[model samples]
Target: MFILTLSETECRKMLADNRLARLACAKGKQPYVVPIYYAYAGDHLYAFSLPGRKIEWMRENPLVSVLVEECGHGEEWRSVIVDGRFEELPDRIGHKRERDRAWSLLSRHADWWEPGDLKPVTPPLSKYEPEVFFRISIDRLSGRAAKAA
Candidate 1:
């Protein structure tokens, strides 16, 4: 596979198109990776989740690695990897706002918000009161783009 550096515009495009990312966090020697839905605003990545296993793990360890990638037909692909620290936002109102923002992003890409039964059954913030929202402050960001030869 060939690799080329992605420009800022390219990086933003990739971020805008891909709504799902894999977040990798480690505590001590063990590492954990989980798929998350994220939204990019300015220079930060935001994601929301209810208090769960991942939230507990992140509370114990804040450092993380996130990967967002897109692969199309003919092997054309792009990916961005971010290494940084994650801060969990505890404000309930703020968490709700960010959760709405993330859902908006998903609605744009997928049919999750479509006008039908296929749409999300319950209100986005109903079950998750003590929601966990995080902002990833990117310490290092790198990307690659490649096309099939």
Candidate 2:
């Protein structure tokens, strides 16, 4: 098998083709990662979620990373990593346009509200969790692919 580096175009294509990714964020010295669904447009990865630990942590630290991977039969696989900054699109006058754009992008897929809008099976604190729309402005993107010789 051979492992090769993917070009920027390939990396972006992977991002565009995939919706699910592993989002990683840090707070002080602690690091947290979670699976999230996103939409790739321009230079950002737009996503939605409810108020939770990941959201709180990301608000404190906007620096984040995302990993998207595709695995095929046998030893074929491709993975892309994105280093980015987080920006929130709140439901307010100033962000109405951005929020609408995010909604439009996210709604393209079936059941796009899922996981993000689903209430926790067991309430963490029995508090209302509001939906959040945000985007990860990609700073750098890198990828690798492995295929049989």
Candidate 3:
């Protein structure tokens, strides 16, 4: 068989249907990727996380990428990559509406607030505090798929 590039519609559908992805961020010459759960709505991806390396990196450098994939049978697979900018939703004036919208989109999942909400095992993270909501404004997205002939 052969691989084919997925259209924008297909890529958006995949993103809307999947909640898990690898969130990639970088600072200077270093890069980092971590599993994350997100909600796709309009032109942004909403997600939550504790403050740490990933958060700090993104804060310093908003440029980020997200990779979502599905691998089924031996010869079937689909994956999508999104390049975008990250923006944190703070609980303050002027940003209330967007923050609420982000929350609404992510609340659809039963366990939407997870690992983010889980307490640190070894040491209660000092970085975890207040509300942590953010969105990734999609700049470019692409996908590919393959199936056995």
Residue-pair clashes per candidate, as listed?
A: 0, 0, 0
lDDT, model 2: 0.93
Model 3 residue runs over 4 Å out of place are 126-128
lDDT (Cα atoms) of all candidates against the true structure? 0.72, 0.93, 0.90
Candidate 1, residue 33: Cα displacement in angstroms equals: 0.7
Candidate 3 lDDT over residue span 17-125, tens digit each = 8999999999999999988889999899999886677889999999999999999699899999999999999899988999999889989999898756665468656
lDDT of 1 by residue, 24-56 (tens): 987778988877777777677777676665677
Q: For model 3, what is the alpha-carbon lDDT of residue 52? A: 71
Candidate 2, residues 30-50, lDDT tens digits: the string is 999988999999999999998
Q: Provide the global lDDT of candidate 1 against the true structure.
A: 0.72
Candidate ranking under lDDT, highest first, comes to: 2, 3, 1
Provide the TM-score for each candidate, comma-separated.
Answer: 0.72, 0.93, 0.93
Q: What TM-score does candidate 3 get on C-alpha atoms?
A: 0.93
Better of 1 and 2 by lDDT: 2
